[model samples]
Target: MSRNKGGRPPKNEGQKIKQAHLRLTEDQHKKLMQLEDQIGLNRTDLFIKRVLENQDFIITKDVLIQLAKVGAEMGKVGSNINQLAKHANTIIKNHQLPPEIVAQYNDLLGLHLVQERELYKVLRQMYRVMKN
Candidate 1:
């Protein structure tokens, strides 16, 4: 077998290295640390990756988590609406539904409408965040 070279791989022969000096405020530093933790990159690597890749810098983990939660809530609301629709259809087919069943269905439909409105608000908030 050939002898192994244990050190780091050689840099590209045509590449030139440059150094930058940056000063960060306390808040800036904290934000940087949060990004580093979320992205799983060190400060230098994160800076280099961002510069070289021209990546979009938006949507933190917290925002993503919130969006996920909103999606889950929307899904639950949709499932509930579907169930209500099925129940309403069954009542219509029977043509002899009790008053209490009709009232309960109307109440649940109102509640689902409120949930849908809230979901729309969340979706709008997400759109605004993405637009910026």
Candidate 2:
């Protein structure tokens, strides 16, 4: 025979355990594994955390890939601009460059600087999104 206890034992002890069964396709499983690795959580824990926190865990692989490609392209553009600037400097140092040509180079450099600033802003926004 057992004695009667209070209304509730404690927070965790008073709660009844519940089980949920999930079925995932092969691709879904693989994606979940990838997400687990990226988020540094196991499959069950990650799912539980997301559900309990009421958080949306939607992975936008396409957008991430596109952003990476754009970043690479921007890097290439920056590299090319750097090489062009070095060549121009060398030429200017070795031989006399016309004032008009120097002025044109300066304008091109300014344009590249503006482009770099814009790209940096976009990358920062993307980083913020990824961080959150």
Candidate 3:
């Protein structure tokens, strides 16, 4: 802790200062100004308060427990997918394959790729929202 001129510990003594300029759309600017008028706080103070609120702080030990639970569910889904691919390979091996089956598999893989790309787009949008 850093001491002030009177030798008392200073609040937020070691905190880093932020110096980034943010751009807002005209509509967003108008809305934020309206909020500022109603709340009696300037844009800077309101923005800082919102940024602080958006920070993810650990509330309890159970937070990690919840994350682990979700991770396990994802693992199960991955394992199931792997098992499905293995079963499909086995079927391909056991059959005198027609071209249609191969085409269907290729189409399914393409669909998965498209879905993955869309998912990434959505996730990027969510991250942008969080940052803003």
Candidate 4:
């Protein structure tokens, strides 16, 4: 029978023998802990991924949770806006809507649509981040 050496195999790239010492404030430490919990990476691995892999830690899990809640509330507001627009259209058909009210309603609806689009874009970005 043949005997073999029992250690890690040699790496094609040079060994990672260097280390870095960094300072952290209270907020920074808290965020690092949050990232460890969310991404299942220790501080060292997180730093390595950030520095070597060029990964961006823009949104944390907690921030995404809060944003999701706000998005849900905004979704309800959007439903109400649609209902109001429908009622205004009915009033216009009956010639009961004033020109000033009609103009303001149009303006408000346009702004609401823009805001809703922005919200969806944010949600999409959050989804992409979580997926990766």
TM-score of each: 0.49, 0.50, 0.40, 0.60
Off by over 4 Å in 2: 1-59
Clashes, model 1: 0
List, in order, the clash count of every candidate structure. Answer: 0, 0, 0, 0
Q: Pick the candidate with the highest TM-score.
A: 4
Top-down lDDT ranking: 4, 1, 2, 3
Residue-level lDDT of model 1, residues 1-132, one tens digit each, is: 999979989899857577787899999999999888886667776776577655555445676788789789878877877987788788789887778988987897888788778878877876774574
For residues 1-132, write the lDDT of model 2, one tens digit per residue: 998986966668645387678899999989988887776667666766588655564345666687789878978977987897788789889997788877897898789789878978877776764575
Q: Which lDDT tens digits does candidate 4 get at residues 50-80? A: 8876778546567768887997898898798
Reference-based TM-score, model 1:
0.49
For model 3, the superposed segments whose C-alpha errors exceed 4 Å read 1-80
Q: Considering only N, C-alpha and C atoms within 3 Å, which residue pairs clash in candidate 4?
A: none
Give lDDT per model, in order.
Answer: 0.77, 0.75, 0.65, 0.80
What lDDT score is found at residue 126 in candidate 2? 62
**RMSD after CA superposition, every candidate:** 7.5, 7.8, 10.3, 5.2
lDDT of model 1 at position 23: 96
TM-score of 2: 0.50
